[model samples]
Target: MNRLLRTVFLTLVGLFIVAPLIVILVASVSTDEVLSGLPSGFTTRWLSDALANDQFQVGFAYSIRVAAIATAWAVVLGTSAAYAIHRFDVPGKSLLRAVFIAPLSLPRVVAGFCFFVLYASLVPAAYGTVGGVAFAHVLLLLPFVVSLVGAGLANLDPELEEAARDLGATPWQAFLRVTLPRIRVSMIIAAVFGFLTSFDEVDLSVFLMPADTTTLPVAIFLRLQQNQDPVTSAVSSLMIVGSLALTGLVALAARRAGLFATRKERM
Candidate 1:
C-alpha cells in the first residue's frame, strides 16, 4: 500500500509539473479557440511568424549576447569564490559567503529596483547598457554556481590533492591535476543553469533594459501587455522544447559523472 501511494504521489507531482508545458505546446500549434477546447486545427504558421518578426529576432540576438557574457563572468567569479570559501581560512569568510549568496534572499522585483536605483544614481554610464543587464544576471546566478561548486568541493577526497603535493606538484599543478578535474560536472551544471536563468530572466531584466535594446523575455513581456498573440505561444513552445532538451543533456552528463547514482548502485 505504501509503495503504491508513493508511485501515485510521484505521478501526481510529475503531472503537475508537466501539464502546463503540455498546454502551452498544444496552444502553440492550435489555430484557434484553445481556451474553449483542444486544437481545432494544426498550423505551423504562428511559429514561422514569430521567427519572421524583426523585434523578436533582435531581442533573441541581444538575449544570447547578454546571457553568454553573464554566464561566463558568473562561472569564473562564483567558482573562485566557492574554491576560496572551501579551501582557505580567509578573514570574514562567513560574511563573504553570505554576501555572495545574498542575491537570492531578496524578491526579484526588489533586487531589480535596487539595481535600477544604483545605476541611475551612481553608475549612469552602465544604466541601460548590456553591461548592466549582464552584471545583474551574474548576481542572480552567483548563488547557483557557488552552491553547486561548493558541494562538488565537499565531495572530493583531500588525500588525492595531498598525494599530488607529495609528488612535488606545485599548489596550482595539484589543483589543476586533481581537484579541478573532479568538479568539472558541477561547473558544467553551473554554466548551463546560469545561461538559462539569464536567458529566461524577465522580472529583473525589465528594470535594467535600455529603451531601444531589450532582451527576448522583456520583448515577450511587452507584447503580452498588448494582446494574447499566437506568436507568443509558438515562441514559448520552442523555448520549452529547447530547455527540456538541454536539461536532459545535463541530467545524462551528471549521471555519467556519478552524481546521480541509481538505488542499486548506492547499495
Candidate 2:
C-alpha cells in the first residue's frame, strides 16, 4: 500500500512539474494571435521561423564551440586533480578540493558578475570574448568532474593498483591498466554534465559574452526584451524537448553502466 501510494504521489508531482512545459510545447505550435488562453489552432510556422533566425544560428555555433572547449579542458584538469587527490597526500589537499568544488555551491549570477568585474578591471580585452566565456565555463564545470571521478576512485580499492605496480607495472602503466578503466563511467558522466551545463548556461554568459554575438540562451533572452515573439516560445519548446531527450539518453547510459542496479544485483 505504501509503495503504491508513493508511486502515485511521485507521478502526480512529475505531472505538476511538467505542466508548464506542456503549456509551452502547445504554445509553440499554437496559431493564436493573443497567446492568452488555450491554443486556437495548430501550426509549425513558429518553429520554422525560430530555426531560420540568423542570430540564433550564430549563437548556436558559439554555444557549441564554447561548450566543446570548456568540457574538454574541465575533464582533463578535473580528472588529473581527482587522481592526485585520490593517490597521494599533499599540503592543503582539503583547500584545493574546496576551491574546485566551490563553484557548484556559489550562485551563477554572483560568480559571473565577479568574473566580469575582475576581467574588466584586469584584462579588458578578455572581458567579453569567447575565450573568456569558455574559461569561465571550464571553472564552473570542474566540480562535476572532481566529485564524480573522486567518488569513482573512492569506491575502488588501492590494492588493485598496488598489485599492478607489484607485477612489474610502472605508475603510469598501473593507472592505465587498472585505475583508469574502473573510473570511465564517472568520467563519461562528468563530461556529459559539463557539456550540457556549458551549452545551456545563460547567467554567466550574459555578463561575459561579446556585444556582437553570444550564446543561444542569452540571445533568446535579449530577443525577449524586444518583443514576446512566438519564435522565442518555439525555441523554448525545442530546448524543452532537447532537454528531455538528453536526459533520457543519460538515464539509458546510466542503466547500462549499472548505476541503477539493485543492491542484490550489485552483490
Best by TM-score: 1
lDDT of 1 by residue, 1-267 (tens): 999999999999999999999888888888883445777898898899888988888889989999999999999999999999988898999999899888888889998999999999999888768888999889899999999999999988878989999999999999999999788888988999999999999999989977467998898888888878788988888888888899898989788867667558968
Clashing residue pairs, backbone N/CA/C < 3 A, model 1: none
Model 2 over residues 1-267: C-alpha lDDT tens digits?
A: 999999999999999999898888888899974478878899999999989999988998898899999999999999999999988997899998998899888999998999899898998888767788999998899999999999999999999999998999999999998998788888888988888899899988899977578999899989988988688999989887886798789879888878767669989
The Cα error of candidate 2 at residue 235, in Å, is 1.0
Q: Which stretches of candidate 2 lie over 4 Å from their true place?
A: 247-267
Tell me the lDDT of model 2 at 116. Answer: 92
Q: State how far residue 217 of model 1 sits from its true place (Å).
A: 0.8
